[model samples]
Target: MTVLDDSTAPGLVGPPHSHGPRRDPAPLLPDPEPVRILGTPAAKTFDAELQRDLYRRLVLGRRFNQQATTLTRQGRLAVYPASTGQEACQITAAMVLREVDWLFPSYRDTLAVVARGVRPLDALTLMRGHAHSGYDPYEHRIAPLSTPLATQAPHAVGLAHAARLRAATDPAAAEDLVALALVGDGGTSEGDFHEALNFAGVLGAPVVFLVQNNGYAISVPLASQSAAPSLAHKAVGYGIAGRLVDGNDALAMHSVLSAAVEHARSGRGPVLVEAVTYRLDAHTNADDATRYRSAAEVDAWRARDPLTLLEGHLRAAGLLDDAGVAAAAKAAEVLAGEIRAQFDNPPDPDPDSLFTHVYARPTSQLREQAAELAARLDADADAALAAATDAEDEAR
Candidate 1:
């Protein structure tokens, strides 16, 4: 039987239902204001121990940014995107996840990688132009710092879905491992970002997307990127919960991100959290932020620096003293020294090592190329040794 429209059957015609019923969009919308825990009543109830820990991490994260930027100027790092003002987001993103969980970070998120237990020097390997990923992803459960925008989102989704499938089949050793994918505000424009969120929403996979909306996507401001009210609102279209939080407030970031991570781990659909923050530094050491942004604007953000904000809160509460500050500084200095030492005397990367572990069975072309390179290197070494021997004979 064929259903007829009003032309064929008057009873078939529906009233005011051209596109069927519209879903309630209000439920999907983010809070009217970004969530704030600092300088609010909520701060009073926040755990003091957690606040102190966050303070230490924030201090260290800032130092990491500074050191990395300096390394770029000193010709150690190839490039550095200093997340100076966005330390709160980086710190909270790392601290919220468990060891069993995975973190997919962007190129600028070296601090997050370090916070997740990757050595500071190893985390900088990609930026140092030394390796694809300095440390193995499996070793730390963190993906390589993604240089391509939004690519890691899908990777996180796939990993989260895979983990859920394993947990479904194996109950004894099963654990709730959440995949936290971090992307910048600019990354949301990429197709991969939408695809990842769509997959997570459909599968109810254990994944959380923390988008740090650091004002500008390099030189292009967010206003020029999209007309969406906020980046968080984009999640509503994918049938997932959206959140907005003050990214600069460590406590707020921790609270919001922790909830999202827990929600994902509990097998709830994925959540999109847009942290409202600003990039204090240029896109990278090479890019001049002054061209796109104003000094006054940068000054305004610097006033609300993550470290300063947290430090003030801690001091007011008597949780941090002068001694505590000194201790944190000492720890940061030690880390800076380690990073400098590693860079100053970095181990020479074997060219042959690049050909190794690329595949289970090497391709014919790869084998040929590796052999060619090895032969060339051997010939060069032999030539150098012969020259040294001739020099010794001349000396005698």
Candidate 2:
């Protein structure tokens, strides 16, 4: 049944010695440094670049979220969600992915979107209830942000499946692309999450489910989300590997996400990562955290704050020197100025666009209404102009 080809396979294109005295693939990866609780051994990756990046990224994300929240409150935005303390989960995980990988983010994943190069202004379109969002996600390797809880997980699975198909067909597109879908802790309670997990596992889809464990689903805490001790353990039901990382630690997050991406590329199936972090802000512009939670609890979580922990490690390692920290702070100040400038003078609506875009040919009812409105407006304008002219003639 072999249709033999004289030509060798593309990857096998090497001189006869390319295989060079076969060696067992060195252990897939060196054993990773163990997780640290608070400050045990510091997780080994707390070096200069990692520390600086972690600190600046958290600061940048926080400032951006705060500015966006202010924009919403000032009636400039329709709505907004702050990633807030979950910056570690978003920014560092974005660093773990190659530009070719796809990200399916939720409404709250604006920082992750920014990390992947989506502009902050574009994110506001969706929240502002625009007819169409301004962001072209495919151009940025991001899918549209899903507001429907856990639904995007399956879309991530579908994207991975599509990548697998292309890899099998086109040599040019063969590098396996891992698709990541970020979801909230409450989202995992949906049936869609289970279905996506089982399907991705069965198909060996290169996908990662990043659960941002911000401790609550609005007012409900993780205690009520699921009975599993940790959400990552849910991977067991699908016979996939999973890990729980201190989501507040960017270095630890990157270490785990890099491993998960490698595992998925090797066709090991999807990996579930439960990132343990907290949401310092309300679920959105509408929700009130104080209504459901006590001040002590918020202050307590803030004490183990992600930014403070990263700053401590940075100063300890001499990566974030006082000068560098000052530079980052000033840069953030500039960024705030830019966001304010944009919010002050935003895009104007094309009023008649309501009937122009939805269908190439207008429906009968829409056409009739549009014509009536246009004529009525024209008649009113004519009457106003005539009245003005009459007043001028009398004055003359």
Candidate 3:
């Protein structure tokens, strides 16, 4: 029996075939070693102003993550998936995008959301158990901090594809539009991840997928989650560019993400970036990380902390002096205070607000449910008033 090859049977090989030369996947593959900027000669050429800005944001992001975690302990926040050690990736992801571009962030990407100009308290509303989404997504061009894993990937692709279609008719907006979707390592296992990437590749959507491979997916380690060479390598199968960067290295992440964003904006299609970072904190305030990871492992990542890595580079370069360090610390303190004050007396969302955005035109069932809820609330108010009046009469 003779076996058929792709040369004779193009149909058997699927969509990778075209009339011209077959695209080489080798050039598109990520580096064997994760790209590094700090502790290297490349650090010298990096823009001093951008370096300093990244440093400030990383400092603020670390403080923000800590503050959110503390709120969870204080019962102020319902839950928080703190991106403590992954601040580099968070800050860089937000910094790379243009104002017109859209950002689809994961639940753990609160830092990214705030970095993109979303108010600190506003970003926390969904996690605070108050409303569906805290701020208007259209106004800020940020999709809701997605609670469901990998779901935002498809949404980002759809938006990017739509924008590309719009740009085809209007050349003025062509270069200004792109979309970014962030996902965690654990989310990569979801079927949505595959679907989104497949569609993005086929449609040539102007989107970037940033996968922060922060060692674990809650309790599951990366080893158990994937047997692939690296998360970035998965992009090769989709026929797009892939990148790997030191996620803890702020400058490296900023450089890589900036390139990817520009490529997407220029209509080059999607790029998948896998940032190798570590999550120092537990899954959340409620998790016991000690049960899953050893203290030695956590200490190792802490030693190579994103803040200290950038701070060390800045200090050695003389771009950041004693006064500069003090100023950054003071700014972070101010942010922490602001977060505390806002969350201390968080605004109570109206009970009826839930039904307001349920649909463009609410269905009959939703209308009935809303009426029932309103009636129940009125009855409770009447009962409380009657009880208070009876007590007053008895006292008289």
Candidate 4:
């Protein structure tokens, strides 16, 4: 015993070194080929009503993107990130959620926000340079359109985890509350994305992450983003399930997102979905897409447009005819007209609004700054009035 070698030592070679238990990676892995339902035989079995509704929404979403981009050009919006080619992912993400559920959208997801019952104009408030978010987040259970990359991911996880904890004590209060966060493929490279996944997996939070992999993140293409087989594959590392769907196929997006929402609502933890899509337009009105990608590439994605795909499927299934197509287009035009009418009469800027929501309780420095600004505005107004009075008297 005193002459025991390293191999025979109790501490050095203890029981072949077992590390608890190993988890099966197969269940977490995503399908090699993205799931397709629009052109597949599965389309025939999908609900007729749901297919019609999805088609309608996809058409409306596309028109919304076009109108919003036009607004940016006309100076109505400070900036607009059009979800043109990715309308299927945008609309389906909103449609799958319940009223009790929450949606966290990226800056480019205005279509999703509006589809979730938020007013179309309200969805563009931030892009219009408004100081506050356009709509009441509580009313819609939708978070403000997040401008920072991957920041919304953690917020979605935290809210879902808190809801799960609360549901543990008050069973009915849970209502199977789930949170769905939308992120661009570029966001996947962020540290916040990684941390959120880790936390979500460890806590078994009821959250779903939908990554709209629209080829390029701004000017950087997906090839430069990550070398992972697919963005969904990243979920396996966090012990969560992963899914890949044809982002341009409305039916596929609807099916995948619905399943993901149900999976999370059942307290099965988080799911990461990668929707292979393309951003037909530039990243934003400010970016020149031609600088990075070719014209042929954009045209190729345009051929697989979400609206076109859904519309084709619906027509083939006899769910949509000439009249139905006309009706959907008419509704979309009405929405576009409403948005334009609202922008025609711009809201007057309120100087006080600058400090309104900055803090719950203003700090001393903030109060001082506010006072200084107010005094300056008052003085300027008084000077203008005096000058006007003098001009009037001289004319008399």
Candidate 5:
């Protein structure tokens, strides 16, 4: 498939109806299907096709995460963190937007990145330790995945703020621009989180913070991260709208996210959605979760796997059959093989290339260091460069 380019969004064409009021506006149902979906809606509310697509995306994303984790164990990656319970939170939110919307993903939001049209193996490029991976974010309107937990939140706010400036610069250019940010529950502990919310709140920036509350930060549980009972409530302190959703239920996640994105795109300021999810795997490749958690707990959460639940829903909807499922599996397998090949076929960085991009102009310190290091080995610059390479390899 063609990776989306700059021309794909804003002016791109889709079903004309895509721009209209979304879904049904019927009064919300009662407690039996409580609105807190993953509470059920009092009644079925999504279009059949929309429901099916959500199902497919969730299935593909979950399987992708599972396979990537498996690959990590098989030595195909340097590290991997399974977004096992958070696929619904991502796919649902992404399904509602145009390519014009901006996505700021955390390291674990691999699914949303894929849903936004990033290639699968390309998604794994980061884990493969490539200098870069994934297509250009400017074309797709996706910011590079943020490794530091809460940093992306403010950056999303900044992007939305910039969008507003752009829209104001030309009245004819104003359009509905949405900014979506996905961060894990542990990220709430950082000051950047609070600052970002306050910035958006004050400016009424078109931004949304999708909090995948996966219940654990590495070995540290929620209790150790923050004293708040609900991460959504953090928005109240910032004077913004907050919604709590069941992250495990794909349908409910989509519904809530659709509403949130619409609100932001219409310039209604910001929204904070707390997706109550669980981490069914260790934090990353380096950690042994079994040491800090119980096997019983692990088994119990496995039973709540988002993939399995969504698969059951699809089968019930008569949308997924053996052939369809088989096709998706085959496609993912082929993509995985390609990813493995790319990782195996390595590229060597030029010894001098790093210095070329180190600055727009080489700083005095770097120039002196390069010159001194070059002279120490009797002008065989390769010797100094080789020594540096050895040091990096040793540190690793």
Candidate 6:
């Protein structure tokens, strides 16, 4: 009997049909070594003023993380996923976007949200157990802090695609608008991640997915989480560009993310950037990091802290002096103080807000539920009033 070879089969041969334009994967592949700027010759060429600003933000971000962790301990916050060692990725992600652009951040990205002009208190509202997102997403062009893994990826793509479509008819609508979604390494395993990238590549949506691969997905090491060469390599599978950078290198992260944002804005389709940083704190206040990671591992990463790395570069370059360091520290302290004061007496959210934005036109069932809630609230108020009146009558 003769066996048929699969390579000679009718449908197994060459690229005979065209589905769409074929892209060169070589251009999309990330560099073998993660990009670095701090402590390198490239650091000399970066803008001094911008570097100074970035350093200030890093300082503020560090303080913000510390205060948030403390708040969790004090029971002021329900939970906080501190970005202690990933300040560079967090702050750079926010700074790269234009005011018109949108940001979709994960639950661990309160630093990015705060860096994007959101009040610290508002950024922590969800962690404070608020019913509604503390800040108005429409006003800030930012989605709520997504607690669900990879869910914001699709939302970012949708917004970017819609903006691109609008720009086709009215150029003014675009205004170089793009969407940047920040996700953790763990989120990459989700189906939504694959779907978002697939749609983004096919539709040529103007969006950037920044994966902060901080070594672990809450305790599961990257080795166990993914077998990909690197998280950035995953982008090439979707026919989009990929980039890798030292997540702890503030200058490099800013540079890489800035270029990625512009690339998306110019309609080059989506880009995926994997920032190789480390998470210094536990997943949250409740998580015992010691249970999973060794102390030496944490110490190793602490030495390469984003703040210390950037500060050393700045000081060595004569861009930052003792006075500058002191000033940055002072500013950071002020921010920490503000966070403490606000969280010490956080205002209670309106209970009715739960039903406010649930739907554009409330369904009958929703209306019925809202009415029932209101009735209960009214009854409680009436009972309190009657009890107070009775107490006063007894005193008389």
Best by TM-score: 4
> Which runs in model 4 stand beyond 4 Å of their true positions?
1-18, 390-396
Most lDDT-accurate candidate: 6
The residue-by-residue lDDT of candidate 4 on 1-396, one tens digit each, is 543455667565434437666789999999999999987899989999999998888889989999999999899899999999999999999999999999999898999999999887788999998654798999999999898998999999999988877888988786678999999999999999999999999899999999999988899999999999999999999999999999998888999999999999998889999999999998899999999999998888888988887887788878899999999999999999988987887686787777766899777888888899999999999999999999999999
Local distance difference test, candidate 5: 0.77
Displacement of the residue 325 alpha carbon in candidate 1, Å: 1.5
lDDT of 5 by residue, 83-120 (tens): 87778887876777787899998888877887888876
TM-score of predicted model 6? 0.92
Candidates ranked, most accurate by lDDT first: 6, 3, 1, 4, 2, 5
In order of listing, the candidates' clash counts read: 0, 0, 0, 0, 2, 0
Tell me the TM-score of model 5.
Answer: 0.80
- Deviation in Å, model 6, residue 138 alpha carbon: 1.4
Report the C-alpha lDDT of model 2 over 23-117, residue by residue, as the tens digit.
Answer: 23222222233244336575454465666777898888778888888989888888888888888888876788898899998888877887888
- Per-candidate TM vs. native? 0.93, 0.83, 0.93, 0.93, 0.80, 0.92
Model 5: number of clashes? 2
TM-score, predicted candidate 2 vs. hidden true structure: 0.83
lDDT of 3: 0.92
The digit string of per-residue lDDT tens for model 6 on 54-129 reads 9999999999999999988888889999999999999999999989999999999999999999999998998988
Which of the two candidates, 4 or 6, achieves a greater lDDT against the reference?
A: 6
| Alpha-carbon deviation at 170 in model 1, angstroms | 2.2
Residue 54 lDDT (model 2):
70
Q: RMSD for each model, in Å, please?
A: 3.6, 10.8, 3.2, 3.7, 13.7, 3.0
- Stretches of candidate 6 exceeding 4 Å from the true structure: 1-22, 385-396
lDDT of 4: 0.91
List the lowest-lDDT window of 10 residues for candidate 5. Answer: 25-34
Residues 1-396 of candidate 3 have per-residue lDDT tens digits of 123566776656545546756678996799988999999999999999999999999999999999999999889889999999999999999999889999999999999999999888999988888986888999899999998999999999999998878778988776467899999999999999989999998899988999999999889999999998999999988888899999999999999999999988887889999999999999988889998899999999999999999999999999999999999999999999999888777768888776877899888888888899999999999999999999999999
